[model samples]
Target: MKQEVNELIDPSKFRDRIDIKGIEKSLLVDMLRKMVLIRKAEEKLSEHVESGKIKCPCHLGIGQEAIGVAVSLVMRKSDRAFGAHRSHSHFLALNENTYSLFAEVLGKYDGCSHGMGGSMHIVDNDNGFKGSVPIVGATIPIATGAGLAAKMDKAGDISISYFGDGACEEGVLHESLNMASIMNLPVLYVCENNLFASHLHIDLRQPSNSTSRFAKAHHINYNTVDGNDVVGMYKLLKSEVESMRSSNTPYYLEAFTYRWKGHVGHRDDIDVGVKRGAQLDSWKKRDPIKRLADSLIYEGVLTESEYQYLNHEIQNKINSDWEKAELASFPENEFLITQVYS
Candidate 1:
């Protein structure tokens, strides 16, 4: 089984190289700016969580921002997306309001979930971010259902479910994949193989670290890539999504990346008892943002001064959004039972 999985991904056939020559300078700049904004916003969240200003448990996707940004660039407003606990990047990439995100984390009434859902249960139906939940594989089936609905409606929309590699352990994920494939549902299963479920590494949890094998079992078309390369993700997804749109078929993408922070919270600690050792440091060196920035510079598409200017602009925007969220009022006492169902 491991050999079959290993055969599925050939390193020689997969290239880290990306062509940015035809990509517009302005678009590239915008992508870089969005990435910086995500980074800074998470940084602020970290500060708040650590200072005890934000009481809710937060999952920061500091190192995995590129995956969401790259995927969103090609997605339509009508398409649906679902994410797991570490999902700030996913929401932000879909052009969801950062202020609402901040407010939701602060449990303010102006939040995306109207201050009720806290960090985990964020939703923006207008933005096509159906929702994000804390449960590992819960959203997989939900996304599959969305895809089936899209197919029934004859809509060109696709459903995307983003989850960590750990979510593969859940039996429902495989069942969802099988059903989606059998029905020809228009869903994209994106497994961000960050190699850890909380503190346990992929090697410790499964026989083979690659999650694409499961996709193969379902007879779904799939691809694996270096998750840190935003441009690479864009290139691969552009083709795969186009194919899915035409055929109304399901596909899978296993993105190999790492998270800078631990499983939960802004802290580097995985938990009170677990040790991460030097893995975090090694992952930092493979930072997606830095690598993409370097590639942009190397390709002569972005200069150092231009990059700095973009970073400054993003920081200012993030600070403004944070301030607005901080001042937003909490939900009124009477409103608590208003949105609830009997």
Candidate 2:
């Protein structure tokens, strides 16, 4: 299947640099760093999963890093962000603490979810990330409820729901969209449309590649974004996010991106059963981190050496964090009885 080729979802279609005109230097650098940190952390997870060090299944968003980073930067810390199964990026984008993630996956007591949730169930409420679950489309309605709560509180904070295109198949998503639209709730629905959801290419499941048609049905504003273009993504989502804050209405953003790693583990997922090898190589060309780094280097915002250094810096941090996470103690047998609530 020729996925995302020569289409609007294609990386060649979007040419704006992360260091584009009128953008702040610091913001660009920060976005780049966050994206790098997320990518490195996920890569480490992938390595461990392949080596059998991590027992928990991890979903790596290696190429789909831009959306989470851009959205995190655009949305305020007070805004509540909820994530779906593949939410390592969503969590790290806000907290940037891989130690918690590493610990959580390792089942250590100091994990973000106290080693109970593992990779799919991490939560960092202090950083505005409420939680992520393995259930598909579970948090859309929860985010909608948070949006309604935000409306009732009059606190000026919005709710963000991050899910993949596959979650669009769920009935609760439509209900959440309708409720948010009709009630004028301030919620931002983020769809990471990576063309393939869980080993099946989207063409087999979705009649039309775009999921924003549902937004039109609900009278909610919608936009399809180049999820790989971090700078462009920021400008587009930031405006919509700001507008949603004032209007108290819902906004839907569908980001077109691809995942370098397979659905579950570290491999391309072909030999394991998925027929994605044909298109996987091409999708790698549109890698989000590389695109942003190239643009930044081209625009002279940072040199190649600096970019390499940034990568090295993040990798070193990940290494240290992973070591610390490994040494952390696991919950004692009695701890389960104490922690489990009625």
Number of the top TM-score candidate: 2
Pick out the ten consecutive residues of candidate 2 with the lowest summed lDDT: 1-10
Q: Candidate 2 lDDT, tens digit per residue, 1-342?
A: 322323755544554444466688788889889999999999899999998989997988889899999889887778899998889999999988999999999999999988888989989999899999889999999999999998888877899999998999889989999999889999999999987778787778877778888888899998887788888889888788887888798999989888888888888776543447766677677777777778778888899999989989889999999999989999888878887786
Please state every model's RMSD to the true fold in angstroms: 3.0, 2.6
Model-by-model lDDT, in order? 0.84, 0.86
Tell me how candidate 2 scores on lDDT: 0.86
Worst 10 residues of 1 by lDDT: 7-16
Global CA lDDT of candidate 1, please? 0.84
What is the clash count of model 1? 0
Query: Which sections of candidate 1 miss by over 4 Å?
Result: 3-21, 270-275
lDDT, candidate 1, residue 165? 87
Q: Compute the lDDT of residue 63 as modeled in candidate 1.
A: 86
